[model samples]
Target: MANNFGRVVEVMVSNMLFSMDKYAIEGTIPFDNDLLPNESEIKLWNLSKDTISRIKRNETLMINAGYRGDVGVILHGFVSSVLTKREGVDAVTSIHVLDSQDLSKRKVKDITYAEGTLASYILKQMVGQLGLPIAQFELNQDYRYEEGYTASGEVTDIIGKVAKDCGTSAYINKGKVYIRNLRRGADDVFALSKGTGLIGSSEPFEEEKFKGYRIKSQLQYRITTASVVDLKCKDFEGRVHVRSGTHTFSRTGDFMTDVEAILP
Candidate 1:
């Protein structure tokens, strides 16, 4: 009376999602960086001598990019946001360039198919952990499919939680993305970095660490249906001749509910 066909699909799809997300975070964090495979591209912000002395006495600071004059500079962190606000200028901006030799290129699905498939896999996993029956069937089969939508949308929404705790930009597009030791929802878009799928609002969170940043799970699950029924039958005492086979109980209505007893 046990059917594991559903479980087989569940495990396969869930494993796919989990591994893909894990790789997304791992791969992106170092892709834009020049470090080796085993290296980590993360660090806490170190303020300038002037900035530090000022913050010690004052509660805020202002920063401007053009103030560096003729040369470009890279500044990262929350302190930068506070400075941007104080400077009274736009804190973010972006411009997409065409590296494509063919401008006719376009997209109906994700520009990154693997990650999109990956997003679907992650979504399948999150809903599975929701402990809701019909969740998989509902989300996978019942939902409408809109190109450039849904699967990637859901994965981005949930991954946002982990990214928020990780204090990094958790985004996906094309084949590359980046992660850094960012402030809770800070983005590097203003630095000409394009970002999508940021971590969003959710329930209360806790402080824990994985790798280094504080971490918390946005997923939970439980069995939605489970039961056992007792079945009984009288023992048959007579043995029939092997050459003469006899009809047993009629096939119709002969089935019994499987019994599973848990003893103390």
Candidate 2:
């Protein structure tokens, strides 16, 4: 009803923000650690001669996006690939990005903890060894790492093992690592209404497939994985934590956030 879909997508390269309004077609940035790699894709309608020369593989990129004047960073990574295609009168360019964790997957490391090592300490040490950027971190009570847990593996794998032992969920968002209890009703940000932000009917949860409601909302709220949000519809009413979410924008000034939230 209201004109609540305006957005701005900014792309930074070589420490400068390029003029993207003219090139941005549509882009998707997914914040997920389980199903898909935390990555982003920007489809460009037209690529200028100078812009083409400035972009190169392995360069660091920072993608910032905002909706209705509320702006926050959504992604950080390095350029993985770029391709171009011709469509009649217009040329299209596509850019792929890989998150920091993707960079860490290149090497293997050994993990050895003496008897009775704290889980939080182990996590901190592992992250430091991997040289990953952390924007936020949380851990509840202390849990000891028992003896004979020595191993050598990818850093992400070790972190997941530690989270399981501590009875917490570990995830990375916008380059930050989180190890905390599962989110529930008390963590819900606000209620959803039909015209306000909810897009369509809520899909019932199916445990067999690990599926939840498919929701499309305005980039009006700060939604991320493991954060609880409330949804009320004719067939459903409850709070669910986001399992995965994607924020996307197009040059035509359209902005949307899609989420798959699950009941805790």
Write the residue-wise lDDT of candidate 2 on 45-64 in tens digits: 77776776677887887877
Distance from true position, residue 11, model 2, in Å? Answer: 2.5
Candidate 2 lDDT: 0.69
Q: Which stretches of candidate 1 lie over 4 Å from their true place?
A: 1-71, 75-116, 120-207, 210-264
Model 1 lDDT tens row, 111-184: 23242243334434543432222211111122222332332333334534433433333322111222222222
Model 2 reaches what TM-score against the true structure? 0.83
Which consecutive 10 residues in model 2 have the weakest lDDT in total? 179-188
Per-candidate TM equals 0.15, 0.83
lDDT of model 1 at position 34: 10
TM-score of 1: 0.15
